[model samples]
Target: MLRRPQGNLSYVSGVTDDPLRFVTLSQALDETVAAHGTRAAAIFSSEREVMSWKELQRQSDDVAAALLGLGLQRGDRIGMCSANRREWLLAQFGAARIGAVLVNLNPAYRSTELEFALNKVRCRVLILARSTAAGNHLGMLRVLAPELDQPGAKPVLESRRLPHLRHVIVLGEGLVPARAERFSDFLRRGSANGKRRLAALAAALDPDDAVSLQFTGGTTGAPKAVALSHFSIVNNARFAARAMQVGEGDKLCIAGPLHQSLGLVLGVLTCVTTGATMVFPGPDFDPLRTLDAVSRHRCTVLHGGPALFQALLDHPELPEYDTSSLRTGIVAGAPCPADMLERAVQLLCLDELTVVYGMTEAGPVTFQTDVDDPLELRVATVGRVHPNIEVKIVDPDDRIVPVGRLGELCVRGYSVMRGYWEDAKRTRDAFDETGWMRTGDLATLDADGYCRIVGRVRDRVLRGNRLVCPEAVEALIRRHPKVQDAQVFGVPEVKPEGRSDAKPEGNRGEDLCAWIVLAPGAAASAEEIRAFCRAKGEAEQVPGPVRFVAAFPVTASGKAQKFAMRASMVREMKAREIKTA
Candidate 1:
């Protein structure tokens, strides 16, 4: 177990004894290919596409050269809108090789969101898949910028909606837009001269140069562009691999989308840095497919959130697949209830499961459980500070809080992002004078240097002038065997018309509302849930208005949309004339 910190202060800097390779992503790829020439670098199982390290290097260079041939300059932004596929990987590494920032467009984004992202980043080129099961991505693009669909006198697209966007490169077979080029034709356009220029540009690149732009999930508000450098993410991947003890020849199943930090920086980049083989089960995450990939490839590692694990465990055929090859992997991007973690370890044969805690602005991971840590620490806490990173808990006044006290989690380290892209005002608000990035997450540091995230700062509920943390109640609710998931929030007391009363009866200004998802084949009423809470929790911890919900609105990454749920509950209560306690 992680004991008390060596210092007297609340601050902790991860011990930096191990050397980190501070190299660009392109250089890292070259070095990996040099060391592991014929090793399987990437495998897209559904597509039956497998590339050796050498092949990845050559193909990435070809794409890089192609971008240069198309007049894309160094430092230009290129947007990609697609699911997890072989082409996404190619665009990611290829754009990095030429120092052009690859802007990851969420495949779930419609035309409006897509237009905002591209125009916000000033992307000169967009790489897209023609269609997906989710929607027709190309049709959405055409709807957003119709100039692309129209034949111009010179076959050029000039859209007021996307002034900076120049070319649209389609990945799959489809009707080519006037301003779009086919993926294969785009590749074939590269010349020997362009290849030579790509080599020179790679040689001139610096580790600190911003190589990629990942938009924040925008759950709280508008998604801001986060600029990440090669220095930040490359070293982050190195240390993350070290924490997981990933090594050469380890087959890692990547179930998350490649756009997010989890899949791009941690999953793919970590494998590149550690010489591990990356296995993509399919375009989207499927419990059965993930299990099949692990069994078929003997994958030693897997990456996903708690919901994905829950799905795997709930699958009827989970026992059919042999998962003995899964020695370790990450359960991150959302809260991992203790029961879920235990179930994963027991059923999936993952003896070394880690819980990683981070956000996009911090290179995605600043604290993670070590493979050797006790299961209690792994389940109850987010583990200790990461290597080469510094963390401190601070109160609202920005003063450092005492140990074991709840406060805002602050991080300062090599992995800290440069800033919100091109938004100086937002960037200035994100950090303090000392350069500590305020995480906006309420957390507590234990005496043993372990940290536990309680909730978001905005998630605090005000009840009778006292701050109530919904996560505390939610945790208690999740402990119920019949409860599959739970969310607790504060609802403003609504007064009846013509009442003109000081406040509603039994109202302390706010009432606690609970939304729950029952386990499969398990049924629980609101009274039963409240009774269970009363049995397990104190008076303040029990929710006043308990609600049973079949599902929750979530982001693409599976993060529960608490705000959306709150709005939905408010509407339901007003419509049903439900009274709160």
Candidate 2:
């Protein structure tokens, strides 16, 4: 058991004294594939399908072959959109196996919503799920097909399905009339024996080879694509799994979307490489269904954003479900409440809950408050850096701060992203001259190395339990006919009762609120704005407080002065409460 901080407990035990060679993600997966060829790899849901290690290998290989057949060359971008399904894994591994970069799209992104990402990434092939409990996938794709670049337009594809897009392989129920091939059909048409070829491809990949395009909330309305490679992803996952001690027979219930970092690296792949069973909530992400899945599946570990825990505890049916199987897991994407962590142990029977602090750029970076730590520390802190991670608190001048002094969290380790894809200016700005990746999160490391995230130094918002990608939200708002310019942020947070003080400017804190300027005569109401956000009954980066403006207060660079909007939110919330009262 992790004892109280009487003194610095020696953390030397978890580390190896010998030199260790970092394995790339492809190499890691390849080794696992060779070691556990026929083992049952993944299980989805009842009446749903399962993929054994052997089957997973063959399917991904076939997918790779089909992608190759389309003449998709190395380092080409392949975007995929799907709920938790067998094919999602196939697509991810298939793309990686053939040295193609994988770009994950949120399943909720409609065709109109996907266009920006598709265009931004210069996508070659898109593999998507046909349907889920939420809506029709084929319908969404068909909607996006026509928007593809015209012949001779930029952002080329592999098969040229939509003039600019090369091919579309439907993972589940397929899009007909659009002429996209079924994922299974595409797989079956190819040779399943690409073992030697895939290995050769893996050998060509180095620790720094960029393999994935993960978009994060950039400044204002620009989406920054974080390029992560096999080495960064695999090494980080390896250390994180060790820190969490995830192993066989452990059933991991994931409420986070499989598309995000929490879902992809920490949720899906972490479970897979660790031999843990990953259980995804069916469409709609209802808390009751999550509890039901837990009670029925006897899920031992559950990973969720902070909001899910709120819904789970508030769920009227929560008492009926058996959650005794739960022991340890995480509240990774956002800082959780002290009370919530308290209830997790005494009320919910969680052995422990980890407050993971990291971003898409660098993750599994700092893991705070282990399974055996005191409740207060676990709930309030993001713990310490994982065994392999190196974290330093640096001030604005790039100097290391004293213990407990809040500064930007700088990480130099396996979790650091390679760079922003094809955007050298952004990548250069992301880090200092040194190799350290500036996380832009304001945090303090206590004497014992526990990371306490105070707030963010960026204009983004960490709303509830999810990273409210303000850039994307603002971009969408900007595209509206009536909107001319906008800046978004997380407003006074309703999460974690104690951490209620909202900081509107500079990152590691606050909930989201947006300021918008109407085009000539375009006006909007709260209802219309919210209606625009509601999708499948789940809110994803839903905007709050449509602060209409004649103009956004700007800096010399013409950047929006978010602090002014921050002041507005404080006043608006106060006034709204007073009127309601």
Candidate 3:
């Protein structure tokens, strides 16, 4: 009984007249603390650390003072290369206090990716963890800039490679390199006088100033730096807080990496803007840990991608966990598959599970389902346009398509990012003449204003929530001596069920597949190629299955037809009919 609109226009604006307050993140934090100082602000369950609003304010002030003592100034880029932890939150709010842009570095990034992020943003101060489960972060940093490990190293690293970097502040206690300062010592250097100065600095700050930079996977090449302002993210977080009906003492469990917008903006800032307690299950997403944290903290809300929710539901001990406290949660970054949403509602105690849709360029989210909406709407669509935002579905000719017609989705609002940092050409190309940010997602708007994302118009691969650029991975693979040419694409995969009677489950997710034209007579196995990619690239970027191809199907323009490759792989896999179940 769906009705279709008669008009040719396909634009829609959010109906709410909710005021978007203009305030810096530091100001927002101050206001929250003033209102709820005694309330719990953050809890790191794994570390057994808890902080009230007052404690968080004091620690963040000290961290800001330490950064100022390190000679960082307003508008300076400060990079945080660590996983989720108490210190990460400290750096996040601390940088906001002084107007320093906090650059989010993915924890999974290797030496090459780390080098690119550090140098690309011209990070003056770099904050990092000693190491992560993946590998030694400091060791990799030394590999990128070996000057740190060498004797008689200058107090300030004089690397021609990273000329803008002036100081390295290592987080947590460990063997501190002589070239870097320990986080504890750095914090001790801050005095009472510096805290007084921080007040004046906060007073002079403007909401429009660029306060953070997030890297997004590129369509043309490597990832680009997305610059966002305090104004943009604050308003987005406020809208989200309102949407989720967040309130004081409402514990929110977060399992995603803090580097992503989901964790930092939606999870952290939403709690700060509202008066909710931010809970971190662990440094990374662990289904059991997340469930445990929710049960122990009596968390009312949880936020993560679909994969995490699925993992939680699929856990063998799911029935044993007391998740009755969970009333609402957000499942984003991927589609909520068949039966998954219902299962989440029934088993996880998430009766008000909502689905959100957005990209990094749009300050993360512009569409989300209401808590009271029907389960069908919550799973089938990305919900209506958010308040204070405008959306349109346009044809290739820049004209608005009729409702229910598939077209590229474009958005216009305060939530839109300022621009890609320092890339004028790309920035200009991202927006239309009328200032609409082209989202590159093919979608259709129904007469009721609900949007259904169909597919992507751009040539990119999405493995879970991670945006993987085939060209970027291909470029890395091509560097192999035996690989003459390479193309990476997403191939639909199926996972075998453990039971003999169960049918093989279609993952509805993708696996990275690489088709390479090897050098004459060169032979390579899938393991060898994966290992090579693992050493040189990110684990996510490494192809799961390697195929040796003599040549690729190309169009008349000599462009590799990735769609053809995907189709061929799908057909080949289906023909094998391996007993995955």
Candidate 4:
């Protein structure tokens, strides 16, 4: 039902006659359990465990009762800092059941980022793994809250740095610090009275109540906590589930981290609405583990970013396992190259692999390709807007651009987030006066309503007098047979001596740089890549300096960190200049 009423204008709306479900996530889970009690609700492949809908309900109920017994009340903020695990899922639903807002903390975050997030949201309780690849999370907590290490420390945390934090729950079998509670013991503390209270709280919960605080990718600045209400995410998941044609029989292998909206909202919530089986390949993304999960569980759906799929396709043991069970999936969180999409379709057997375009603020999904869409549409554009959403491409002056014209994408609909947590100024700045949430993504709307994302507005590289779109350049570079992936960005050009007319510090022009990850067993020089781009066309499109890399820096959600790449390149260039001088 996507339509462009005025063919000359860039405004489009996804019209749907179906009424949106107005229920809390707790209510949604209850309905699904009633309908599919015996069906498998979750499968932790790494742990060799499976839980049916009925079992899932019982475990989540235990989690809710435990939190209630700890004196957590409605609207209290509880933080979860861990990789994908059964406990993370339980905490997500449990907090929602008691109307507590779960603040998703990235497991990759270090002490500085972690401290800021907890204090910013005023988290009363935090649940974390003992350790991760990042480091010892429990150790970091001790550093931040030295009171935890004091003699005769009580279970309640008292830290001057993190004043709002009162309780710390550690996951893992071991002797926890004196001020922390073990997850096992914490879960066992639930009482019959607590269970009754949980039920009463769930019954009184409203669909509009905020259920989770998902942090943004923070590519531009400090990560903002985006508050999402049950009404927003549930409907968003329902629309996405409908688009993917997910059902109770389908098993989904989720490679994305549960801390992000991609995992919790799209992956988990979508399954809750459709009764599909949710599969966690492992705590962190491992191609081998993911493939084994798909082959072993016969997972019908898969979800991850472009980098994840690229790793799977490039794995040496790819042919050793069967991926034919992957009939449908979602490739999002970054710009997807056409070559990568084609490879996923042929190698992973994801014929219905869709491309989703959204940010954390848009309930994580605003536009998504349909299952039956053409390969070209799925590869080239993030398809039409989701039902009950409105989209428009606007110029700098806020005028709607014409179809086929590039402009900033803006959206307004039920799926948009309430706002950044406790940041009124940022929330006000995120939308227009009329309530349209500015996406900050440069994109073009086709006559058919397909959206081709150009790149980030700030990510455009200005070389000489021309502005270069890094996404376009990266797409061209990825077509090289020797290249597996490419990230293109602007590096500040060193100012020549006595150049008084040079642009100011922030506005200085930049030279195009390309960081390429070579295809396995393939070798190529920087000059060869430049020559390849030169032969293709457009001298302006060719990158000035090409550097080979094993991989590009990426966020937890798997989006390439172009700003980080740009800064690193600038530093390298400056060092070179100093050595030459």
Candidate 2 achieves a global lDDT of: 0.68
Which whole-number lDDT from 0 to 100 does residue 200 have in model 2?
77
Candidate 1 lDDT over 252-367, as tens digits, reads 89988888888999899999999999999999888888889889889999888887888999899998999998989888887788888998889998899899899899998988
Clashes of each: 0, 24, 0, 0
Candidates ranked, most accurate by TM-score first: 1, 4, 3, 2
Q: Provide the lDDT at 103 for model 3.
A: 97
Residue range 31-68, candidate 2, lDDT tens digits: 66677666656656543656666787777777777777
Clashes of 4: 0
User: Which candidate number maximizes TM-score?
Assistant: 1
Q: Choose the strongest candidate by lDDT.
A: 4
lDDT tens digits, residue span 1-581, model 3: 11223365678887557878899999999999999998899999999988999999999999999888777789999999888888888899899999899999886776777888899989998888888765788888777777775555444665667788877888888777667777888798687777889999999999999999998853344678999999999989888877778888688998988888889899999999988999999987888889899999999998988778889998999988899999886887765664789999999889987788988899988988888889999878988788888888888898889888878899998999999999999999999888899998888888888888766667556777876766568868877888878888887754433434433455467778899999999988878889889999997888876899899975321336777888888887666556341
Candidate lDDT (C-alpha), each: 0.86, 0.68, 0.83, 0.89
Per-prediction TM-score, please? 0.93, 0.74, 0.80, 0.92
- What order do candidates take by lDDT, descending? 4, 1, 3, 2
lDDT of 4 by residue, 12-130 (tens): 98867767888999999999999999989999999999999898888989999999888999999999999899999889899999999999998888688899899999999999999
Q: RMSDs, each prediction?
A: 3.0, 11.2, 11.8, 2.8
In candidate 3, stretches whose alpha carbon ends up further than 4 angstroms from where it belongs are: 1-8, 151-155, 459-581
The CA lDDT at 62 in model 3 is 96
